[model samples]
Target: MNHDRSNRVCPVENAGGLDNGIRKFLQNPRKILSPYVKAGMTVLDVGCGPGVFSIEMARMVGTSGRVIAADLQDGMLEIVKRKIKGTEAEKIVGIHKCLSDRIGVTDKVDFALAFYMVHEVPDQASFFKELHEILKPNGSLLIVEPKVHVSRSGFEEMLKLVRSLHFEVAERPKVFFSRVAMLRRLA
Candidate 1:
């Protein structure tokens, strides 16, 4: 619960830009997540704007798996609900409204995706700590920040905090216009 309100959270009004074809072409969710996600695995899409990554995650996880689409804005969650309605993904994707101070999810996830949204977090230490708590032992968290927003030094600072929290660097994946880090929770 260490979230601070000073950070800029994406408004629901601009959500359309987050889930469009142009973005999909540049940052295809399936290609970015296929290595980490699997059928029957429980996953999390943090700051899932308009369910872009959440919808794709639902497909990757299959019917036996679950994709938690957690966001602070109810408008964003509503968009996710609408996108999944009447689809097979409806049963696989769960929408959760995150608390201002924390993620507020109780279930431990096998994998978590933080795409282009970590820069929006005000208290990253607390944020990463909470993520550490919710990830199963050896579980992976893929953190992707927009290169346009987060500088190399800023991303290094984030990695320092991530390491201090007992998460090890799994790898650095190449992503279009993004600085990516795959972290694994220690057992």
Candidate 2:
């Protein structure tokens, strides 16, 4: 968890402040998405804010799989990019700037995560559709949105959206101040 707090556009505490050990403690993301992620599976971290979990995911996917760290802010992405630049791990990770909620994930990725950032999205329906399209067969999309700042109705709306797309709620972790919405694309 390496991050510089200089960029404060979101007012949300830097997502990368949780230390390495602490990150391991929160590795329950696997439990949330479960068997979908293995040692060699391509992953997408949408709205990767500052690459906190993206770093952890790189370790999970190991040397075989690739993790694409994407966000709308180049400033924040640059911070995370520099934090992990020039290393063996760099080969397994990539960064991108996409604001259209298009996702841009290819058929290779097995997992996608939007950690505590989905509700802030300008259009939930559009984002969910894009996620459903990019994921491979049976691919998983784990959405963790703040239950406090975000509306309950919106979460329900997403639930409906995912279900309509044939995605099921695979798991839901008990996240503090937030609710985890894990959905899996039908195989």
Candidate 3:
């Protein structure tokens, strides 16, 4: 399906649905992220919706690490802000506002996650390129797109673009209902 980036961006009104008990059961942030995220490792959650993954990622990364919950919508970031307040995660997770076509984070991260959100990018190649630049050398990027919205061919097309930009396929880990691609930045 041809999707305009703006239309594909999840509206903040529906942000409540993005994080809930069922999603936790299916996506299980820790299980999907544990292998790549380590204590004191800085990570980025690109398009983090309501911080479902960000909060848990903070716990995984511990006090020394940082989880940047980057999103385009201020309301969504506000939701994350509220969720982390007065919690240990508040110290570890930082909410960042992104532009339509840019993540805009200056810090190099040990790992990055684009969960159910890459297809919404207006320019996939540029998106991957920026992701490549922001990642530390040999850093890992885990991209999980919803299978229902992204076709197999479309996902492969993205992979081709990602590889062309100096990212190698690290592994394809299984997530309940997602097309998963784990990539490593080539030094």
Best by lDDT: 3
What's model 2's overall lDDT? 0.71
TM-scores for every predicted model: 0.95, 0.80, 0.96
TM-score of 3: 0.96
lDDT (tens digit, per residue) of candidate 1 on 77-143: 9999998999999999999988877998999999999997888887788888899988999999999
Q: Global lDDT for candidate 3?
A: 0.90
> Which residues of candidate 2, in runs, are more than 4 Å off?
1-36
TM-score of 2: 0.80
Tell me the tens digit of each residue's lDDT in model 3 across 1-187.
2332243788898987888899889889999999999999999999998899999999999999999999999999999999999999999998899999888999999999999898888878778889999999999999998888887888888888889999999899999989999999997
The lDDT-based order of candidates, best leading, equals: 3, 1, 2
lDDT of each: 0.89, 0.71, 0.90
